[model samples]
Target: MVLAFLTTFLATRFVTHAIRSGRGPFRDASVGGVHVHHEVYGIFLLLGSGTAEFAYRPGGGWGSLLAVLFGAGAALTLDEFALWLHLEDVYWSREGRSSVDAVLIALVIGVLLLIGANPFDADRSAGEGVVALTLLVNLCAALVAILKGRVVLGVVGVFVPLVAVLAALRLARPTSPWARRRYPAGSRRAARSRQRFPPGRRNRWDALVDLFASVPHGTRPRTATPTEPDPEHTR
Candidate 1:
């Protein structure tokens, strides 16, 4: 799965760059005068692979191949997730950054799965009750983190229960539900959270994202032009 994802991602990026730079004969795919996004193909692949897996209950080599297909589909779909969300050609806009974030998140989750890190780490000798209890506790922690809007942390924490617990206990992002409801405006807790995640910190994070994601030039939000006062009003 990891190999499939990386292969598709890199190949897509390379082709896109080559086309953009006029170094490749390849052009954007279109039909009936409408541009076709790769996500369409991705959706089909996912559906086909999922159906094949379910119908045949494929195992061994066939199962691995199906998994690869699914991963490839996931890569293509997530690469244009922001376009689906905005229902526009935001592929080269600031909104496109979401696609990069999604890819990174998917990669992290895939790595965790590959590592075989189980969330429910109870021993078989510990009995069924103990195993169930452990799973329940981890689930609750993961739920709390997710509810607090630490989605990435919550997802990754599923494989590391302690991380979920810590994230759940920590202050939520300033704009998250937990912060808005639990840390009221002007409250000390809110103020502290704001300090921790200041505007500057967000800007720095954005810089890192741009650096890693290789965001296209001119995609950043444009500054609004300042309007001059009317001559009559000024006089």
Candidate 2:
């Protein structure tokens, strides 16, 4: 499943890059003069695969096939995640960076699970009630982390409870929901948060994002004619 998702993501990015440059034969898919986004196909694939799995409950190779289909569908859908997120085509825009982030998070989590990161498993030495309480506490910490805008940490912390507690105890991002509610204007923590995370500060994560999801304002290799619609603005 991971392999399928990774392959589809790479292929989709390559095709989109080609369309942006008008270099390869790859062009945007359309139907009856209306632009057809790849997510539409992904939605169908997801539905089909899901229905088949539930109804048939196949095993072995059949189950593997369905998983592959589901993974591919997920990749296609997530590639345009920023589009659905903003209810507009944000592809090639700064907002589109979220799509890459989402894909990476999902990929990392999936790999972690495949490699045996099971938070649900409890130690035999610990009582069930203790395990349940611990799980609840970890979940609350995770929620706090997410609200604090430590999204990657919050999500990953679900599989590693210590990370959740650490994230919960940290300062919230200036624009995060937690900060907006708790860190009033001119507050010390608010100022500290801003100071730590200065605006327009390009970090390693930003560089990684730009490497995979370059925006129109960046150094994207494209030179569309004035008469033609800028490919950067299209899917």
Candidate 3:
């Protein structure tokens, strides 16, 4: 469980940071991405731990109950995470998510601490303790990130460290940026030309295109030719 949570924490963190620091509203995108990463990896963590506990211990004792409690705790955590994610998805979704999420998180933490404080077989309990610790760490990091305006870091903090490392590797690869620049120079110029207009009735790209095309290549406007004189006026 510890391994699982840590894995998620690291992976989530790296991704969130990458998106936050990238161009545009990448920060918001990063938050959404981190939430996704946590959901995917967090499930694995829960499954692996539950399996391990069942395989070796072999009975529905207090130990099993503890494991079940943790599993439920994780489900609650994810639900709250999802609520927050939805709130971020639409502006109106935020009305009650924060308050509800806080309560859910507090309950998860309480259960985790209770399980950790109980006496149990040292080896197995150690694993459970580790899992609990991971959740706690993730929770604290997320709160800090939200309060400090670095919510991406909090989202990323839910993933394992390896994901973050991998993200860094991908960023450092020359092919990543090179691929993005594959568009022709003319297209690039066109893209830049379109940015002047506000995104209103017309599509944003079209507006930009219109703006760019309207500008003369050289600095001067085209001069109009003089019309031929009328016969009556000339006479």
Candidate 4:
């Protein structure tokens, strides 16, 4: 899975850059006088591969090939996910950065799974009762972390239960639902959380993603404003 993901991700990035810079023979697809986004083909490929995998249960080489197709489809579809969300072409906009973040997240989870990190610890030597208890505790911690909007911590904590407990106990992100509903206005905890995880702090994560996506500065779409008529013309 990791190999497939990286292969597709890198290949897509290369092709996208080549097309954008006019260095490759590749060009944008169009059909019936309408420009077509790769995500459309990606969606179809995902559906077909998924159905084939589920119905026929291909094995060995065929299974590996299907997995590659699935990963490629996922990368393509997610690359333009922001466009689908906002119903506009924001591919190079700040909003499109969410897609990069999403891909990074998927890559992290895939790597973790490949490394044999079990969140449930079911494979351990503990008895059934102990394992059940541990699972219950970890589940609660995971839920708390998620509710507090610590998604990365929550996800990683599943593999390391202690991490979840620590994250859940920490103050929630200021703009998270947990903070909005629970942290009263002007409260000390709210202030502290805001200070610790300020909106500006997201720049660090954004920078990491920029290393991959290389978004140009000042390309975000601006809101339109109504124009005023000239006073002399109105008179």
- Model 4 alpha-carbon drift over 4 Å, by segment: 18-23, 217-235
Error of 2 at 94 (Å): 1.3
Error of 1 at 67 (Å): 2.0
Kindly list the per-residue Cα lDDT of model 3 for residues 1-235, writing each as its tens digit.
3333333333433443344334234332123223243344446656765676777765557566546545543543453363455543221123323423333344444444556632223465458777676556555555444343233333443443332233332211112232235324456433443343223535543343343122222332222224422211110
Candidate 2 local lDDT, residue 192: 98
Clashes of each: 0, 0, 16, 0
lDDT of 2 by residue, 1-235 (tens): 8888889988888888767666668877766546688888888889999999999999999999999999999999998899999998888878999999988888988887889987787775287888789889999999999999898889889988999999999999888999999999998989999998788877776787777797423335445555444545565
What's the lDDT of the predicted structure labeled candidate 3?
0.39
lDDT of each: 0.73, 0.84, 0.39, 0.74
Over the stretch 125-182, how does candidate 1's per-residue lDDT look in tens digits? Answer: 3787887877788778888888777877887887787888898888777877888889
| TM-score, structure 4 vs. true | 0.80
lDDT of 4: 0.74
lDDT score of residue 91 within candidate 2: 83
Estimated TM-score for each candidate:
0.80, 0.90, 0.26, 0.80
Model 1, residue 18: distance off in Å is 3.8
**Each candidate: RMSD to true structure?**
8.6, 3.0, 23.9, 7.6
Top-down lDDT ranking:
2, 4, 1, 3
RMSD of 2: 3.0
